[model samples]
Target: MTELPPKPSRDELTERAARVRLLAFDVDGVLTDGGLYYGDGGEVMKRFDVKDGHGLVMARLAGLRTAILTARSSSIVEVRGRELGLAAVLQGRKNKAAGFRELLSQLEVSPEECAYMGDDVNDLGPLGMAGLSACPADAAAEVRQSVHYVARCRGGHGAARELVELCLRASGRWEATVQHMRDPDALQAVKL
Candidate 1:
């Protein structure tokens, strides 16, 4: 296994993550391993990590919004976004920076309040604009170097989940989120 690069200091990550209200991601390499599985009908199938989907749910429960921005549009993406209850899903956007800006505007959030994760060069614009930037272990060299965090896990594995846990922990919501995950009813009772 290739050794992962060192990440930013915990204090620095926590500070940036604390200010994050929205978490955005790229779909290709960041979420689906960048592989296009085409069938006989020229339709593409993308595989998503169940853990990553749950991570989004955890973030939402912790009071953070989630979104997806991709250069390609696909019905599968829409299905996954709806299943995860993502706050925003913007697809077929070649200029990711512009798309990210539009999303921020539509969501009424500032760049400083967002955390973005991507795995390729197309993501650089928004990655630079986000308060906290992250990439998967197998991300492009430029992307890995430019990001604030690089996961040990590869894309379509657990990279997204790792970032989500980092943000939740840094923001002091990990414990509660874990408690709820372990026993939702128990946590609700405690809240009551």
Candidate 2:
């Protein structure tokens, strides 16, 4: 089959990214390091970057809905989603496109308002459908070429953090956000 037309301009992508109402990530690569370790207790150990978690919290505070959609079903992924108050946690989905459609319907958000982050072949289809698509630094060349933004950092490192950082900057809140993080204790007093 022939390829689609040339991708939208960076401005269009960034615009979509900035206006995103929903942000969904593929669990393994985008959230974790794409490596799974099995312990003797039959539990899984996945390494998640602290910076990424902070970015996620910031995004949520900014009123953006977040979610995790992955083909693998694991309690680890489930726990992480619950910890973050994700809008959705879809796992063991062989056809991600279907899951995405279901999510869009449930969230009542249009495709153009959704931003999807992923790193492998399984991610390409949903990535193409999203108005703004992104991939980690270690993603396959094909996935990188298909996405509008390719994070400068690798997965499970700071790739997800870079995505949210751009959104924060685009929204003109990066400086204040950094300061807030630095002085969270001082800021907390104002909340009461």
Per-residue lDDT value at 180 in model 2: 67
Model 2: per-residue lDDT, tens digit, 50-78?
A: 77877777777666788888999999888
Error of 1 at 167 (Å): 0.6
Score every model by TM-score. 0.91, 0.88
Cα RMSD for predicted model 1 = 4.9
List where candidate 2 sits over 4 angstroms from the true fold: 1-8, 179-192
User: What value of lDDT does candidate 1 attain over all alpha carbons?
Assistant: 0.89
CA error at residue 24 for candidate 2, angstroms: 0.6
Residue pairs clashing in model 1 are: none
